[model samples]
Every structure is written in structure tokens, then in C-alpha cells.
Target: MLNQLIHCSLNSGSPVTLTATEGLSSIAQHEDALLRHLFQGYQKWVRPVLNSSDTIKVYFGLKISQLVDV
Candidate 1:
């Protein structure tokens, strides 16, 4: 799982770019499945509150994206 997650995180961004959310957008499984295979510890803390009516907001560069999985 570590290797798979590491590979995914590396591929999520380009050679020189990194995509780590430092603040609010902390909970996510991002591009290249960076957050998918990894972040289990963080996910556990956030998932219980991610109810059907809730929404996830992500910030990339200067843009904000919203994802709602019901």
C-alpha cells in the first residue's frame, strides 16, 4: 500500500509540482489517486462527518472546486 500510494502521489503532480493542501482542503483523495491509496488516517477523521448532504471543497492553484458524492 505504501509503494502504491507513493507512486500515486508522485504521479498526481508533474515532475516539479506538488499538490498538498495545507489547511481547509485537507481531506481529499486527489489526482493520480494521491489521497485514495494514502491518507487513511485523515480519511477516518473526516469520513464520519461527510454525510450525504455534505460537500467537499478543493482548492487548486487559485481556483476552487466542489465535489459532492451522495
Candidate 2:
């Protein structure tokens, strides 16, 4: 993906410039799908409230444009 972005950046008249956002959004959408996939299998182990078996709800989000170098 980085290579493709670089290629688009180097091309002066590429129609692909506007399409970059589509690529980026697709990546983000996949992240949402991945989270849903995880929750589908792992919700059983999560205890949002202790001492109870009540049904729980979870929400998730990502912090954009922030880099963490570990």
C-alpha cells in the first residue's frame, strides 16, 4: 500500500489521486470488520460488569493519524 501511494504521489497527472481516499477507507473498513470478527468469538470471555452475567455491550474505535513507535 505504501508503494502504491508513493507511485501515485510521483505521477503528476494520475487520475488515481482522488481514488487514494477509497483505498484508505477500504483499509479502515477492514479494520472494522476485523474488530467485529474478534468480538463475535471473544465476547463470551469479557465481563463488562463484575458479579453479574447480564448482557453487555461494547463499542470500539481507533485513534487516527497517531503513530506509535515501539
Candidate 3:
């Protein structure tokens, strides 16, 4: 998000024209990248756990809530 903001700010004077669809598609791509990165981080943190059943319940339940907002 900070990188994107910085890029936009630095390119503020650049003449870049994006159609509505293009803008939305770019945003969707960024969102997908961010989500994949986040999920990988979560997996790396929790995948070496002790109890599979409890981890599954906790991770999936929390993921479901986050997915709802996403």
C-alpha cells in the first residue's frame, strides 16, 4: 500500500490515462497479490503447529472472517 501510494505520488505529473475497467482490474490484481502474500505468511507461521485439529479450526475460522471482508 505504501509503495503503491509512493508510486502514484511520484508519477503524479505523468500523463497516464486509465479507463475505468483498467483501473479496477489493476486494483483487483494488487489485491490478489497482497492476499496471496498474506496467506503464505499465515501458513508459514501456523503450519508447524502441534495440534492439527485445533489449528485447522482456529485458522480456517479466522480466515473465513477475513475473507468475508475481502
Kindly give the number of clashing pairs for every candidate: 0, 0, 0
- At residue 48, candidate 2 shows an lDDT of 69
- RMSD for all candidates, in order, please: 16.1, 14.5, 11.7
Query: Which digits, one per residue and each the tens of the lDDT, describe model 2 over residues 1-70?
Result: 4423322332234232222334667768656754564455466665767768676677999887978999
Among these predictions, the greatest TM-score belongs to: 3
- Write the number of the candidate with greater lDDT, choosing between 1 and 2: 2
Model 3 TM = 0.32
Q: On residues 1-70, what C-alpha lDDT tens digit does candidate 1 reach at each position?
A: 1122222223335333335554434324344455343443454444434486777776767768999999
- Model 1 clash pairs? none
RMSD of 3: 11.7
The 10-residue segment of model 2 with minimum total lDDT is 10-19
Over 4 Å off in model 1, which ranges?
1-48, 62-70
lDDT of 2 at 9: 34
Model 2, runs deviating above 4 Å: 1-22, 41-70
Cα lDDT tens digits, model 3, 1-70, are 2233422221235432222233666778776765564455354555655776654435443333344554
Q: Specify the poorest-scoring 10-residue window by lDDT in model 3.
A: 2-11
